[model samples]
Target: MTLQLLNRATALWRAFIVLALLAGTSIEAVTQDNRPLLVAARKKRTQTKKSRATPPKKKEKAPEKAPEKPLEEKAVDLTELDQHGTNTSESYNRLHATQPSSTPNFRTYFDLAFSYRPGDQPVSFENFHSAFLLEYTPMAGLTFMVGLAPPTVLPLYYELDWQITDRLSLRLGRIWIPFDQINPHNTFGGFINTSLLRAASQEAFLPDVWADLGAAAKYDIIRDNDLQVESHVYVVNGFGQGGTDPKGESSSYPDFSLPVARQDNNDDKSIGLRVHGLYRNTVGLGLSFFTGGYNNQGTTNARITMLGADFQAYIAALTFRAGYAYMAVDLPLGTSRQFYTRGGLYTELTLRATDKWKLGILGGVQQNDNNVSDQNDRTIWGGKIEYLINHMMIVSLQYFKDLRQAPGKTNFDVALLRYSLTL
Candidate 1:
């Protein structure tokens, strides 16, 4: 009976195992039939879960607003009057011309100088000055200038300037010839020494070609922050057959004429060249050259050639200046008989003590084979003190000793005091 029971149990277990295997085969077959669909559903569910897990994207920011308009230009006061002689009615005209202005402007400039001399020649107070300078500018590159002074009651200088380019210009009419820095009317100082500058440079072997009917060409060879070079060339009516200007007394080699004659005295016209340079504007140098003809009582073929050099330098409160000139002048006795190289040299030092005061020392010599009629020699030593009363006015006291060694004249001394104003 036990054997029969054990066999029955074994059969029951075998039957159970077979049933489980059949169920497994049926499930596997179903899965194989829907394989593609199951995979797609699983992937779709995974994508939906990922989408729900992430945060939302932010919106884009707006752009900023633009500005309304550009700013307006500043207005100028046209009705304002200037008390300082430096700025006259014409100052505006000059300023306007440098800009783009539609209308022309007119202005006036005034300058005055007075001198007092005491000696056996008698004490005298004389006003030697440049006053009533009128200027007009119609365009950016063009200007017309006219000036009037005493004695002649005529326009001292009248010129038309046309700036052809930034570095070139053309000038016409009576213009100032730049031979020396000392007497160019630049108004560098108040007191002008009659001995040092007048007899040395002003009435030098070369005549003061202050104003002459001519045309000039100017160019800036170099212009920059640290260095600059400028040049000028002029062609004009040269000297005449030097006779007394009806006022009597003519003092020149063959007489470099101060031609008031409207026409040329001879066929030859004079030519002049000047080159100036500046290093940082604290130091300066200039070279001058002139070649021309002179006639004596219509006796043609007389000529004059001149060369000059000048230098200036500034160090702290002190300024130094120097100049030298050599001229080959012809004094026609007959034919091309002879010529002489005569010259002048000068040196000056100035100390600026304060805003209102200045002190200076100057020395010079002029040696000529013939100044008046024979060889002339001169030595000058001078000192000056100046006080600035205002921006437009200055007062100066200067003392000088002029030692002369001439053919037949005794040595003399000259002292002068000057009061000057610029308007």
Candidate 2:
């Protein structure tokens, strides 16, 4: 019985050992089977974490593509609009607004005067001077002008201006050169209030036929509201101010009444240089110098030098002008040195009595050297009354007095009725 009991115990112990071994093997197999799956899951999780960390790079790339499409579309639309002529009106209006207004195509200015002098010719029309100015501007900075006057008394002057820049310009053709205050264009105007005509000194030395055919370049040193300076140079037939005159006239005629003076037939060519300055439009000053020579009959030559200065100022409605000039002539005859000098002062006061009626008082004095003894020093006074019919027309009456007179010689006195029109 003891041996059988021991055998049973041994068998039971062996069975228990075998079962434990089988359980161990199964656990080991299951562990091995799940090992690769666990490793694959962990790798997938790590790759997903790396992809999530790099999200900002994808987000950064997304914005770069959005602006390119809108910019290209806008460029195409602008190009189409430009090609279809939609941009014309604004440019056209801008160009049109910069143009000047059109006035009457045919424009003219004329002055008619009737003068009566004591113990002189009858009260006939002394001068019927008319200037017809035609102007055409093809572009903004270019202008063409043609002027006509009659009777062969004055030359027909023409002008063309091309403004290359705002402050620089070129002017060509025959222009009325400005050297002194009493010039050809301003001397014979019916609107001048002075009663005594231009001074005899100016008539003899500073004649009215002072024009030149040349080109001019103008530059503005100061173009502001306060100051201005302009320089001009000209090359012209320096026929001394009286234009060209025929040679050899008899000396039996009165010297003062002769058409050609002693120094008239001097030279054929000369150069002129002038500078003008203005301050506030109220003050004007000028300096001019001219040098040339004239050849007379035979080898006699007369060299001429002329220097002049002028000033003009307007203080309110009163205008004042003064001028002085020194002229020396070196004749081939002798060393006597013929000298001609003149000084003049003139003033005018304008009284606005009413909207259409105006009154002015004019007075001036002139002193001349080398004039006739009787006419060397003279005083002039005049008065005028004008009616403004409209913007384009004016009518005036004037009276003048000559204060200096000889005991027997008649001092000049005159009355004038004048009418002027402008278009």
Best by lDDT: 1
Residue 302 lDDT in model 2? 51
Cα shift from native, residue 384, model 1 (Å): 0.9
User: lDDT values of the candidates?
Assistant: 0.60, 0.53
Worst 10 residues of 1 by lDDT: 79-88
Top-TM-score structure, candidate number: 1
| TM-score against truth, every candidate | 0.66, 0.60
lDDT for model 1: 0.60
List model 2 lDDT by residue over 10-116, tens digit each: 99999999999999999999989999998999999999999888765533444444444332111111111111111111111112233353421345557677877
What's the lDDT for residue 192 in model 2? 37
TM-score of predicted model 1?
0.66
- lDDT (Cα) of model 2: 0.53
